[model samples]
Target: MLNQDVLRNARSPGRGFAAAKRGFDIAVALLALPAVLGVAAVLLLLNPIANRGPLFFVQARMGRNCKRFTIVKFRTMSAGQPEGGPAPRGPDDPVEDERITPLGRMLRRARIDELPQFFNVLSGDMSVIGPRPDVWDHAIHYLDSVPGYRARHTLRPGITGLAQVRGGYAEGIRATVQKTREDLAYIDGLSPRMELYILLRTVQVVFTGKGAR
Candidate 1:
């Protein structure tokens, strides 16, 4: 069980950790730039022919300290279709929505759709490892309903994180609460070793498509 006091007393990463994290993010982003751009270029050309939509998807997400930032990704859904309102999806909905194009399914399974977020890390809007950012509207909902939820925002959101590696799609309030706990645990135990572990596990998740939705 999580200790409530630990959550309440959680501190942001130290200056050294913060500096190292940002430096690492920039270094990794630079190293991965060519591959990211190559994928984006291919997707841009193929998206028009295969998916018939914009190549990129951008949406507002809650960043550290509840700030809102635009998160970019490859567009995996049919163009112009509305994903219902801000309400969380129910259990009955498909893990990857039926609205996903066939190519989108492949992109998602490969976690390629999320490659665009490396720019967010490069820009300092996010980290390479931290709590996954929540959609703005859903962040509001979770803030109201989940205890210790806001504590996860003490650090910049991430492209991948401990909660993401441990928890799957948060379908409802219950699942959101569970994910919140995992996020809080990660935040409480932040360290270089743990960060490395999450990064490594993320590679496995991407390759195996574990808990991806």
Candidate 2:
């Protein structure tokens, strides 16, 4: 059974919180623009030799209200893996996939691959902090398999979020359920204080390479 508190907290926020969150997203995105761009520029120079694929990997992700949006990340996989290989086994599974280049491993470990999503945040497709978006395929599978899974889509997806920091990559239906709980908890407890906490944790995750895949 669902916890009433979780359900209550997961409800869409009032207009004030929504507005404040948007303001915060804009402020943080703007503040981080220089660094994000700098890294992207550096990666552009290095990636051709390092990874030997397109500079950016663009894929459709389920965003707020389950809308589809294209998310950008540095291409971390080798060029031309045949489509329709087995579904990704888990979130962290990609870290071990043979297609990942050595340099891609380093970038994933440093969380540098995700820097491109700052553009998504700036474009209003995402926030600096919230539930991370899922690829459309995973989103569809989980929507059917995981109860209350759709709840996480009520707000804009985040570049980093409670699930990424706390649970890392969810590997299966059970793990995805746990991640949903964390995400709902975050929504229930949304505030400047919590936002700040997630931001600090994100920095720690990035630097320590605690949960990158």
Candidate 3:
């Protein structure tokens, strides 16, 4: 029988899975905070001249069940455009090539810019592993454009996910669609082993700078 309870089935998790996942997310976030803070301290000291903008870039993102929450990241691009500032950046939001500071490029390459999301994990806004959240505006668009995208939010967003490790960050509509499919597939097969694989794969991606835009 199909679980009929669509949302519950959408998550498709086993007994205590959600609880276990949350516990792990909390543990990891707590343990990692010191390192994140240490790096942030270094970046703070250097931001004045090297980055030339806010130390952190915060934007609203779509969370599980399509709720909105603030997502935090290290500022990796120059601010203050003549027109205004940067626009709402969605998943794989493409920034101007020239706007990427040399330091930002290194952070992106090493995936260090994502460290701030550990706070989101602690706050219950996100998980350690799942689909990366979409920018609120863009997620609204995708909810209308992409089939099965709503299901992607059955679980909290993650700093890393299967699509992210496999395809990198998505840019265009075609890529977003593919990413959505992979996210859904991850949900359908949610398990301990799969999470471990994603964690392991994420390490490789970080080390190799693969799948990063």
Number of the top candidate by lDDT? 3
Residue 92 in model 3: lDDT: 47
Please give the ranking of all candidate structures by TM-score, highest first, separated by commas.
1, 3, 2
- Model 1 TM-score, all chains together: 0.92
Instruction: Please tell me which predicted candidate would have the highest TM-score against the true structure.
Output: 1
Candidate 2 per-residue lDDT, tens place, 5-118, comes to: 787668777899889989988887898789888987887788777877678878888899989999888778787752112245443233336887898889889988888898
After superposition, candidate 1 runs with Cα above 4 Å error: 82-96
Task: For residues 43-90, write the lDDT of model 3, one tens digit per residue.
Answer: 989999898878888888899899999989887888664111224544
Cα error of candidate 1 at position 56, Å: 0.3
Whose lDDT is higher: candidate 1's or candidate 3's?
3
Which of the two candidates, 1 or 3, achieves a greater TM-score against the reference? Answer: 1
Superposition TM-score, candidate 2 onto the true structure: 0.89
The segments of candidate 3 whose C-alpha lies over 4 angstroms from its true place after superposition are 1-9, 81-94
Clashes of each: 0, 0, 0
In candidate 2, which residue ranges exceed 4 Å CA deviation?
1-4, 82-96
Q: Model 1, 121-211: lDDT tens per residue?
A: 8888988888888777778877877888788899999888888888755666677778878888888888999998998889899989987
